[model samples]
Target: MTDPSQPEDTDPDAEDGFYVLHLFVTGASLHSTRAIANLKQICESYIPGKYSLEVIDVYQQKALAEQEQLIALPLLIKRMPLPERRLVGDLSNTEKVLTGLGLSR
Candidate 1:
């Protein structure tokens, strides 16, 4: 379903739809680094030119973290495609990440 808050033209199901993802991680921690790498790899492989990923460091961006209501070190939020989903982890597991992002095949 499409999110009511977003514009109708930004729908993820559109032929040229783009995913908007937010990844919040603690600065330079091992898990954070891994999450970044894993998420980037996944995005490149699965959604290549069709996604926009924003990486935010909680240590540096406390306000943004608070806005997202984060309660974990490394968090991934699928902000588009409606029914936003949040996953907390280093994102090392491909299958799990794919499923969480609704990209599992």
Candidate 2:
């Protein structure tokens, strides 16, 4: 569970309507590595400095992963900007990711 007393618990971009994303991964597996690279590229291209991504390694943060109720690795959760979204996969499909992030119409 996240401590509300911690500064990291607060969202910095909530006021600006930017993205607060959490990507749950497991170690250095091929899919996790691919998802990391793909997510970074997509954020840099689409949201630029407007997004905050927290890549949580499920192996290291098992409790947090369970808290998120993650059923799959390489899961992307959009936490802010209202109406949260989740995507599961290597995130190779840019169009699908963009649409999920509400970056493209």
Q: Local distance difference test, per candidate?
A: 0.83, 0.85
TM-score of each: 0.83, 0.83
lDDT leader: 2
Q: Could you tell me how far off, in angstroms, the CA of residue 91 lies in candidate 1 after the best superposition?
A: 0.3
| Clashing residue pairs found in predicted model 1 | none
The alpha-carbon RMSD values of the candidates against the true structure, listed in the order shown, are 5.4, 8.9
Pairs with steric clashes in candidate 2: none
Tens digit per residue, CA lDDT, model 2, 1-105: 666643443443444577899999989999999999999999998888999999999999989988989888889999887668899999999999987876654
Q: Write the residue-wise lDDT of candidate 1 on 2-95 in tens digits.
A: 6886554433453246678999998999999999999999989988998899999888888888887888879999887655778999999999
The alpha-carbon deviation from the true structure for residue 95 of candidate 1, after best TM-score superposition, in angstroms, is: 0.7
| Model 1 TM-score (2 dp) | 0.83
